[model samples]
Target: MVQSGLSQPEKVIGSSYNHAKFKLLTPSENSTKTPEICHAETIIVGGGVIGCAIAFELASRGQEVLLVEQSEIASGASCAAAGMLAAESEDFAHPFMAKAAHESRELLHKHKEQISAITGMDIGLRRSGFITPFRSYSDLSKYKDRRNTTSGVQQLWWDRSTVQREALWLNRDTYGAYYRSLESEVLPVSLTRAYARSAEMMGARILEGVQNVRLVVDNHGVRGIKTAKGEVCCKHIIIAAGLQGEQLMHQVGVALPSSPVKGEIMAVRFPIDQAGGRPDRTVYAEDVYIVPKANGEVWIGATSLPGRKDHSVSANSVQRLLGAASYWIPGIKEADFVRAWAGIRPSTPDGLPYIGKYEQIPGLYTAYGHFRNGILLSAITGRWIADLLEGKRAEEIGIEALSPERLNRKGVML
Candidate 1:
């Protein structure tokens, strides 16, 4: 098993956007487990970004892995996501999540070349930064202090004139704006498909169309998983089933306090000339952001709501998104709408994601509750869990603050 190192990454300076340098990784060779109705080193229940990532990491580390998904890959929130690697875009008070997200972005960069080589796909990795406007001087003051540092991020303050010159369609009503060159966006479907394909390339047995029923338990730990198709014996089991993780955890009485936070996003396509040759940066104003892909397609999103689980696209929601987008960037008002959809983000009470093994159950690890950061957090989450399985230090990933036991301690489990 080859270990991934955190090589020093180059920082994007001034205004130029350079393609990121990513390491190339080859799949490790291991003995094939003879299919005698038997074992896998790790059995992942979901095939979304998290599950596929875990499978890729485990298999690349010479573990026999099996991934079970009820449908085609990226059919859930992964499919509906408007991928934004924006840690700093989130509130600054949440340092735990901010650190995790920032690290995850770096990990994604580290694995980019390997991921592309393994999947033989682009994955749509881009370096388009984020633009957000401040409504008042108070907002600018608070953000100015935060954006002063240039160590981990490159944020440029923009006045009205600067915003107008840089952002082609920005509304004139903004007080000021801030731009960070580190925030990025990706095509969700491309990333998800590439990750799953990469896992397969790493010798993982991806069994799509099959779902895990329950954990095969013993006094020591989880021995395997019982599936509708058959039983898969495995030394370890990782439950990365987003939105469905709590239900499956409850089957074994390991209650998890997690629920679906529904979000709606609309994708629209405009003529290249209309979009100013695809304005090189992503736009984030209010609760929505517009991401322009390598192709001419643009993705605008997303509205977040708590206690909402519906995936159906609402006409009113689309209208509201369009109206708000029009208010910010008037050119979008005339753009043709291509698609609209919804996704259920798996959110816990606190913003931190759950990682590492369960307290009462050994060999049973839980990796869900990533909320909107799944796409960004996938690679590191995979590497972290792989390290845990290989008897490495848990502090190596600095994820001790995000533990499943926190749900139990806070009396929030179930």
Candidate 2:
């Protein structure tokens, strides 16, 4: 089945804001197996940003692909992402990660253009950059040397006056800021759907509402998958299944060292004639980072709670987010409160995502544990995975540092 990309995403202001009402297709107790058999060169299990990215890249390279999502695409963390491609602003734990994020941002740009040309959809991509306002000069001075360069990402310092001028609504305590134009953003679900639709346009098959998947791995390598529908034969399978896919890996023999990190976000939008208006650049203040969308909506997010799977939004989280946001950008306090929601991000033992072949199981690969960087890392994650599966060098993507085998050496894998 094929669906075209979105022409224009729905505005989140006017309507009563509701999160994506997608129900994940889970393993049914009475799910019966059928005799129907499917075939593909690579089978992707998951429909999040990473899975769609991989599917698009593989299909683009003339591979027969099958993507099976438990529910509608972008039903999980992908839809809830703030979509910040903060390669430099994030200050990754490792040098290799910084490099990966920088490359992935470029890949995202290339894919964004390709998808737009193919589907005539605007993914709400903003290259406006990031505004990291510091309330104290001491805090601002901490990154005085960051202006030099790291992983080829450069930075420009904006003095207090420059920052306040850029964002009139910003509080007076804002000492200075760092302007990183390379840091970009997008509407998360829009990009995910675009990738999936683009893959479909390239003759890749997508099966939504597919669940209860079992790997068909033999002694030699990956054979395919057995779903509730029937058998799907494939040479390789990628478990980009987010938090839920860890179970499948454990059952396959090796354990993926991953856990859930929950985050809550609130949206506050202004009328067309609002006084100061939404900040053009994303506001990455010390307390709360605010991401302003193309529309009049401003997203104040993300209270990180590790090892948390509960997606219920808490009043305390909302209060903290609002309080911090108002402290940084006072004008936002007057904006109309749209809605609040929660999502669970898959985080690994280390900071980086696990994206490489599991040597113990031939042709079996898994890519997850991106934590808050899923949107930023999705592009390269997909491309590198496809290249590796095509017999390309893993060193090109820094699999040595991001390999799943690291968990075994670290004694963290369960």
Candidate 3:
């Protein structure tokens, strides 16, 4: 289901290489001899944050889970994400989304300590908060209701003077800033690897570099999946393959209307003692965001170009992002340029993720179209999907609004 225009696979050397460091499967590896057919309770397609998290949850709950990935884990959007857990900052047009995001953020915070302790990986989970600067009061008025409805979130409206005092590098035109103290950030690649490692430790079979994957369906329901390596016969199949999920579902006569939204981001480094030393929190202004890592590297992103599939970093996007960054933090102009990269994020018409069982096919489930929130919602999506498969009610888990049926009922063409 992981489709790419690049035909050849990248070469990977080691067996236990981290997803962030590993390359794709080589040509010879893709033609390896098929092994014997395997069986599992559930087969999850895709190895991004969502899939890895789901695998971790299901395996931890004692379910026999097999995760198949066409490429290395977290090699997609998960690795490119800025890792902002912005439940409060996100648009909550649908009340249920707000609830789900809130719950997901809580779960992320709750498990941050435990996961880091177990894996000994610094996930860089920080509750350093997020700030959205406003150029005018009219701009602030537009999101007043949304900001107020962020219940249980610590919200503060800082005056221009306070903003200048806290973030001295901001532009003079900045009027004020709305701060959400509970919003957090994490190292997405580290988190995904941690989840995958933890799931494997708990008996989940994760197969990477698997090519030519196809779903095995029967008159009753989805039987399992077949890959270049071998076949996996399972009771259930989950499609969390991000942008490629639509194509996979279409193979089974289901129309999943989703598109790839391309985003470009850049990382800039600064000396520890420099005036541009990493900011204390994530800052958003004029559709650009600056996320600081503990290592004095600031991630300034991102340009969201909808309906774009190419992951090529454009000069225009990079110039625009850097200009915005310089406008927000004057010192950013002097920071050392690190690298710029791009990713294609999956999105739906309504900007809501599809996270439930498909009615047309039994034992077939989906957890894709998360758009920009995949990393933020990964923990709760996994937990809820595992819960649903384990016989928990949708209403009980409060994810009824995220059902796939909503898209079908709307009659949106795939």
Candidate 4:
């Protein structure tokens, strides 16, 4: 519950009249003839969490929705995430983002049961909470001040002795830890697939393995989308394309400032009977996080390389992550190394995600650049997009701060 600050001034550049003057065709548009036209009320791009969530919400509201994906749903960053729903643990620069994250985390609680019931898939939703270990008194004091300023978050400070008693595998050098009881974790891939399955059940068409996808726009607004197979005639299109969003938006004459931030993570298996048993909750130490799954497997991650895009795991990153994990939980060093992988997350200059209709391009909306919090923010972003398309007032959803126009004013290049 961080205190609110003055709302940033809206930086919309020009009126709708100025935007209507430019009519640009996408690269695919020039070569394609009038492709077979399929129709839907709304077409959503990128079948990841955000897109699938929005499709599910829209379909639940009885909107005919079409979701197009270049690859399988959740095959990108959505599946590679550690799935920590740490709203309270995340550092928010704005009060609005904090509130939105809290609300989204709460939404997960409400939807978890429903999603499992509908999809018949256990999403591995766990309320294991999160603990942040500190190395020294000065480090603890610095975080204490930050946490103290946050109004309604429930946090508990643990002494070194208490921390040792609670998590026996922790290093003796650990000074203390802060525990946030409301934090939770989930299996990101399962949760994302659940959303896609539920959306399909609710009558949303999800087209995976699509190729040569591009937007078709006119003076009025978005007319449809062109794909390798055909064209989808739709009035509204939402882009939640993750790392590929920048290129997609650029094709339609929109400048989205986003880049691929690569993260490498590993999975390790531990025996249940091992000495200093596996941690029952998520543990955070500096840049390292260890998430324990119910299946005797633990996830150790991650190294954020901002400009890197290759999914190949480097030995150096793996060594660093594993070394840090072992320092936090001594028993982790003994665990069987399962696998290592990487994903490219979409990152923005400012940390906040872009979530709103483009003022310059009517009927074109975006929900991308969520970075690490994509899984945590999926539910709320879906609801927000649904609300906007349904003509809900901007103030009702408090989405003004996340408007795409902010990037426009910042002179973000394609």
Clashes of each: 0, 0, 0, 0
lDDT of 1 at 335: 77
- Model 3: per-residue Cα lDDT at residue 58: 94
In order of lDDT, best first, we have: 4, 3, 2, 1
Q: How do all models score by TM-score?
A: 0.86, 0.88, 0.88, 0.88
In candidate 4, which residue pairs get closer than 3 Å at backbone N, Cα or C atoms, i.e. clash? none
TM-score of 3: 0.88
lDDT of 4 by residue, 167-198 (tens): 78778778999889889988787777778778
Tell me the lDDT of model 1 at 380.
Answer: 82
RMSD of each: 9.3, 6.2, 5.2, 10.1
Residues forming the 10-long window of minimal summed lDDT in candidate 2: 1-10
Give candidate 4 regions above 4 Å deviation. Answer: 1-37, 145-149, 410-414
Instruction: In model 1, state the lDDT of residue 333.
Output: 73
> Which tens-of-lDDT digit does each residue in 245-294 have in candidate 3?
88898888778788988888888877666754457789966578999875
Off by over 4 Å in 2: 1-37, 142-151, 409-414
